[model samples]
Target chain A: MNIQLIAEIMGTVAFAISGAMLAIERKMDLFGIVFLGIVTAAGGGFIRDMTLGIVPPAMFSSPMVLPLAILSSLAVCALVAWLYKGSDEELHGERFQWILNFTDAIGLGLFTVAGANTAIDSGYGDYHAFVIFLGMLTGVGGGMFRDVLAGIMPAVLRKHVYACASLVGAICYLGLLCAMPRGYAMFTGAMIVVVIRLLASHYKWNIPRVM
Target chain B: MNIQLIAEIMGTVAFAISGAMLAIERKMDLFGIVFLGIVTAAGGGFIRDMTLGIVPPAMFSSPMVLPLAILSSLAVCALVAWLYKGSDEELHGERFQWILNFTDAIGLGLFTVAGANTAIDSGYGDYHAFVIFLGMLTGVGGGMFRDVLAGIMPAVLRKHVYACASLVGAICYLGLLCAMPRGYAMFTGAMIVVVIRLLASHYKWNIPRVM
Candidate 1:
């Protein structure tokens, strides 16, 4: 699959899992859980599009977005059901945060490359390095918000190297797009982020306090 | 003060009050409460301007908006602290939903008229009536969202004729703008909405059920 398609699938799966876990944890009504699942999957992209001045936003205007959201929701529901069936502990009680980290890393990697490419193509100034950075942040910002609203520690703040990975990839994307094939550069950037994030997860890498 | 200025103040006060109440109920720290308060006071207006294709998002660009938000936050926090002083029971308990209704009415009336006038002044056609109507909804829509997120029943879903008051005033303003003096018509629309909303509150006027 092309990188765009791959990124879309990655973002959709990660977001869907996050939503499903939140719904099951909160014990929301079935419909509410489904609604949240959809929102959690697509909400970040929606916000990103709006901030970029994409008229009419994406979810409402795109055929693929809704189907992707629905499929993602079903995938997450099935996974959670199977996992919960095996154990009596809550769906989001203990293992949820760990799931969130992997999902978040996937989101961070894909969205950083996507956002950087989008900015470069939009005829915005190269100085919109800031916009690329902002887009990467916006992509994961919604989940951070969701966690805060749910009164849990935000994954980004959990010494998880969350935003750092995105920042690195975004910079890498811009640098590689300067001289290389766009596809190669994007893949390289995304892979770097996902690997760094997962390695950080395995080794518990975190920024030390400067003070 | 100009009527528009007065309306803006009323809307800001109401918006801030709702934010403060939610913060207190959520037990958020002072910084979190202030952040919510600022977003609450400015959020609707920001949405309105952005949808209208105005740039820089007036809330961020205009110095006046920031101070207004701060003042609104101060007013709400001071009032609540005074009223519920030493009464932790009421402060942290299942309180009645009175203040929500009060602030919602004022916000709905002010924003609908403000939005309609802005649209009309821009020389857009009557099809833009839908846009003005949308602006009215966006004003109250954020609060409805806030309440829902706060786990309270949405204010608009209640029996009160909230959105109806704004809709009526917007229509009345559109009608009378052509026949009467412009300034007079503006005042008349504002009064009509306020009076109707207050009457609805006291008499429990509501749209009949769709069954």
Candidate 2:
């Protein structure tokens, strides 16, 4: 498979897991968990497609995306059920959180590059600001949706360098596109985002709050 | 102007006001208020167009919509500032709430009909379920975005007969389309939604919650 296809699949699974985990934490039922998962995985692309006027959105056109999200979500749910097994212990220990963060960063990086590439292919390559915005939006939009549905402030808006990381990655992708092949630029761009996100999380880096 | 055009304009203004009012309540700055207002006014149409594959969405294509939303939001902000005059009193008294609810119902009803009509015009007239879903989504989608940005559960999901009212109105419109002129059907359908919503609010009617 091409790297872009692999990135899309991995990103979808990672985001689905992230959303399913959040839904479980929110004490949502099975349907809610699965729905949230699907939204978290596909919602960003849906928003991007809508903004760019891509009819039917990628989520609707690509048959495998929804199924992948659903299966990943169900798998997460089943795993949680088996692991907890009536125990009331909190599931968000440091190690578990690290795992979640790692997967989230991977999804963020892959999706961001993919979004930028889509925009470029759509003839927005000259519009650097728009391309970057679409990229960052694709990376963070689904998480925002998930957080909103879970009744929490969006992590992208408040915590860490979540959006900042995406922004940097998008810029890097745009810059690299000038000198390198599209495939290499995309790989490097995604890697940059994942690395930055991981480092930020590990070091407890944060953007300063106004208050 | 036609009734459909009038409905679109009125709905934009009403939803802009609603979003501006909420932003003020949240103590957001002027930029925040205006941004939220535009989103609340145009977000639904944006979503609807994207789903149906209409490029550049109506908000982008229709020059007046964004300006209308911005102006309406600013008007609300100015009015609130003038009325409050540095007072510490809460803005959400019973009368104020009634006004907000009334305007919201109007917007919801008008936008629902507009959305359904758009769907029908887009050659999806035979798809009853899709039409109804699009109608309800266009009606409530903006408010959902507003509430999510304000870090609250969407009002439509929790209280009143918001989506249900829209659903009924869409069905009514579809039915009336067979018996009446298109314009008349849209008018009556929108009126039905407004009436049902107002009555539900006035009577404190609510959908039963699982809990």
**Tens-digit lDDT track of model 2 for B78-120:** 9989988777455767766776778778889889999998888
Cα lDDT tens digits, model 1, A1-211, are 5766567666766776676667667766666666666776667667666655786766677667667766776677777777778664665474676786677667667767776665555555344444454456555665666666566666654444666677778777778877798788878888888898889889977553201
What lDDT tens digits, residue by residue, belong to model 2 across residues A102-185? 878888988999998889889998899999999999999888888887777898976678999999999999999899988899
DockQ of 1: 0.04
CA-only RMSD, every prediction:
8.0, 6.7
- DockQ, all models: 0.04, 0.16
Q: Each model's C-alpha lDDT? A: 0.66, 0.85
Question: Could you tell me which 10 consecutive residues in candidate 2 chain B have the lowest summed lDDT?
Answer: B202-211
Please give, as one word, the docking class of candidate 2.
incorrect
Q: Which residues of candidate 2, in runs, are more than 4 Å off? A: A178-181, A206-211, B1-117, B123-136, B145-152, B156-211
